[model samples]
Target chain A: MSTRRLFERETFLAPLLLSPVAVYMVLMVGFPFAMAFVYSFSNVTVGNPDFHMTGFGNFTAVLGDPVFRKSLLNTFIFTFISIGLVLILSNMLSELLTRQFRAKWLIRFLIMMPWTAPIALGTIGYLWFLDSVFSPLDWLLRTWGLLGKPHALLGPMSNMYWLGQPGLAMASVILVHVWRLLPLATMIRIAGMNSIPREIIEAAQVDGAGYYRRLFHIVLPLLLPVISVTVLFSTLFTFTDMTVVWVLTKGGPPDHSTQVLASFAFLKGIQGGDLAQGAAISLFFFPVLAGVAAVVLRIAKKAVVT
Target chain B: MANVQLIGIKKHFGGVKAVDGIDLEIKDGEFLALLGPSGSGKTTLMRLVAGLEEPTGGRIVIDGADVNDLAPRERGIAMVFQSYALYPHKTVFGNISFPLSVEKMPKAEMQKKAEWAAGLLGIGHLLDRMPSQISGGERQRVAIARALVRKPKVLLMDEPLSNLDAKVRHTAREELKLFQREINVTTIYVTHDQAEAMGLGDRIAVMHDGTIRQIGTPEAIYHDPANTFVAGFVGIPPMNFLEREGVVIGFRPEALLPAEAVPAEESMRLRFIVERVEDLGSHRLVYGTIGGTKVIANLFFRTPIAEGEERDFAVSNRDLRRFDLRTGERVRP
Candidate 1:
């Protein structure tokens, strides 16, 4: 009876030990999601400040807003370009550095520095480099005759607003996101490359596979999980990120031209006096990111089996 | 099948020599095993022959043609890795067909060859299954099938049966031997298991510290081991080693028996205090000590030797393998 009690005590203590983490998750993650869901149904504007229930009104208001529609389109455009570039460039660089050579650690360290740098600081640096006048980039380009004269890249050049024009603004944001995200993707890909058994590669070599044959048939297929996870994370970050846009354009020269969902939400609730709509706009990003994550997770799982 | 020759092959990893100066002549259609413990350079030697690794020095000739600059595929050889190295994402059919596909054989011909190899390995029924779905022995068969489908001049297998269960490894060993005989390809196999090496190799090259200690038939390697290492390494429970006054004496456990059974001139009586006795169904193993040296002797059936019992043991001169105590080499006549 005492032995049975001892066994019961041991098993009972397992869940008891886990209760702290479970409580923390419920309070932090579950409560916020519940609050967000509740806020989605309220007509809680910032100035009026009344948390009165309003069934789906804020969502319908967002769907009707031109600003919200533009933000949605810009987010998709930024994510598509940035994630695509990150996947391709990171995979290529990782494959190159996977080979044994002199100074490999040094090369890896240099490449990974961008990822280790603070994002706010990196974006600030980008802002300085792309400054319209007295920019080193502009000076170098003008000296090479690539551009007409010493001018800020943010200015209107041939009816194109690099920071305000819809297409160019999206492109600027996408390029910055890719630059910042490349190091992470490259590191993950390198890790994936390292995990592949040496015997497998040797087997392929002994089987008569040349470099390209080995890369395409063996390496790429094995690296799919890393690639998928990287693409998923970058997609989420690029779609919702406002740091680079905020630092460079402040969401725009002409009122909110570069506003993505995140910056738009900030503008609406804090500056424009619509808390309920802002909450709804912030929540708009959830489904899209969740869907992409789900698909990538499925792909990653399938890749692990191979 | 083609004969292979390695002339002064060497490889160094930083400051360490993995395959120190070594040469081997492998004849056509012969099954040879590179037998050694881990880090003894057997696998490294096999890789050099397969062209999976570049030799730091020397030349490799296959079928009278120098293949030093040739890649593995170009050398007309195939290797089965210790891990099986099957494409886990590929089906059994696809795994076997990889070499043929790599060679750019016609699709129909590749399929035919894969099917033939699968049939030969008795795995035709599992052609559509992935490598993960199969047992270790089945995966081993698939790896062998992949190598066979290539129709290479030589086959290199590195510790192929080490991953399987004991019974499975035993069964696979026989099947591997049968397949090698039927194919009659010049094969170089590497293994740490001396039993597998003895059972499979037509000629076994025993290696130590990146060099070949001896190369001979299995019976010769066992009965007349070149040095102390082979004598101690070749048998189950290994040969019992004893040293006295610069003379290293060794003999198999079965060779030692009760003194009354043998003629007095052919045997020497030694006294030992029993430490333990174990009954292992078909035989018994006695653990004891003689003149401060521990000794193990096997008996045909369960015997009446008890713990702490003292007894007279006789070892025949013909069965003893004597080596120099100082040098650890065979005391050659």
Candidate 2:
């Protein structure tokens, strides 16, 4: 066959193969995103399809609302704290798992159970575990004399309102998010650690690096890119997550103090019947997430070991 | 500089004996090469000395101190791995200075030491570059520099030159020998290549089946191998063994010559039917069968020999090594 014919065949085949994916994306993700963008600028509401472009009026309203502003702040706090905890805790877990031990597979399996179980189910489980009256944590604390007058720093002697208090509720959400994301980060770290040549670690040992030295100087430096990617993924996962908050508090505690962007958007857009404002509030996620993803990816690129 | 002594060292992986009982005292400032084929346990022995592997039964002594319970770092040894093991993320300067940095050495002093070591290895210009940015030879130099920066009493190199190309290996080997002489460190080199061991080692230890088969000066190991295994393993075109009654006669190809070219009182003569002749530039290898036993003889390319021709070859009596066929141990005269 002529070279030109072969080239023509390849070019034609490329688009033909890609067309299904392109069509699927347009129908599923692309259409909804485009509709959301249009709706965010229009005065559209439930059962009122007829509307005219409001030109940032919905954006102005959403941004001006105190609850929307609070939700935005909460989203950042939730994502940052949860991801920070995930990064530190998962690194420790991965390092521990990588060492030689007995029953390692079983330990790893148990650690991964939180991630593998359905998030909704796991959140519900946590809800019961932290229940106001019959909480295991409160029981343990009370039994240990960590509650009441003598141990004032540990909180009241009575059953602490876990999901009912603003601070405790936020901490609970962040903790659950960290627990759910730890397995993936730890697994990623393990893979990164394993990819390092055994000789490099042995060389470090021979060069007089102790365990901590090897960890800080050799393993952690090599894992920088992997860690960055893990943080990025966990941040994205925690930022957009509403199920945990919705299931536990539904952005409650009287003042919407623990309300995050996703839950607030759900309450305002879907439940409150103001689709335009909801789309505008949800649209706030795009630029912040994009900025975060860009920064993380750049850091990951710079930290590439090889 | 310090001597390293391994007494009754034994390492076993489940049922497999990686390094069986071994006892050797490496002299201070002496270069020793542990030479063997793959699975010969040379690397295992090196790791035992470096404190990288724990011996099942042994005492490792460095500089008159028992270091069996010490970690590799505490043992004060540095190694140049077969893969070079240059930290991929670190610059050459960072890699070379790692040992010092681990000790929290002052920045200026660490820089000076690293630079000096880099200069010694002729890699000073590459210090700012990452290991990935350097050539294989440069990486090897960086690894060596890293090992040298700490000024360890003993240096361990595990096939440090095996990763380089052939031409580069030749120059690196010479430079390495010169560097070792200048530093005067007690060095243990591990390699499977006989040429590398012979060229670099003050004394070469030949290992087989997780045991030291022979240990001697390179000259002694070459001229008077302690056993059949060393005799066979230490030479290129390895020594040919021919069974004669209860004894096995071993002789190198280079030891054999055309009968006419040898004086009568100097060598023993054997006749064989030539099967093939391989002309290798300055010399030729003649393959033949003697009494139904195959043998090869290295001859000058100009020598008059042809395939299918019956020829007489001579080997000096002293050149022929005798061993018990069943035991495969050398018989001393």
DockQ of each: 0.51, 0.74
Clashing pairs in 1: A132-A151, A132-A152
Q: Which stretches of candidate 1 lie over 4 Å from their true place?
A: A1-70, A96-105, A140-171, A211-216, A251-259, A265-283, A301-306, B240-251, B256-325
Query: Residue A234 in model 1: shift from native, Å?
Result: 1.9
lDDT of 1 by residue, B1-333 (tens): 999999999998888899999989999999999999899999989988888789999899999999999988899999999999998777889889888888899999998999999999999999999888999999999999999898889999999999999999998999999989998999999999988999999999999989998899999998888898988878888888888657899888888887776678967778878899888989999899989988899987846678899988889889988899887899965
Best lDDT among the predictions, by candidate number: 2
CAPRI-wise, candidate 2 is medium
Q: What is the C-alpha RMSD of each candidate to the true structure, in Å?
A: 5.0, 2.8
Interface RMSD of each: 1.5, 1.2
User: How much lDDT does each candidate structure score?
Assistant: 0.85, 0.90
For each candidate, what TM-score against the reference?
Answer: 0.83, 0.94
In angstroms, how far off is B91's CA in candidate 1?
Answer: 2.2
TM-score between candidate 1 and the true structure: 0.83
The alpha-carbon deviation from the true structure for residue B10 of candidate 1, after best TM-score superposition, in angstroms, is 1.6
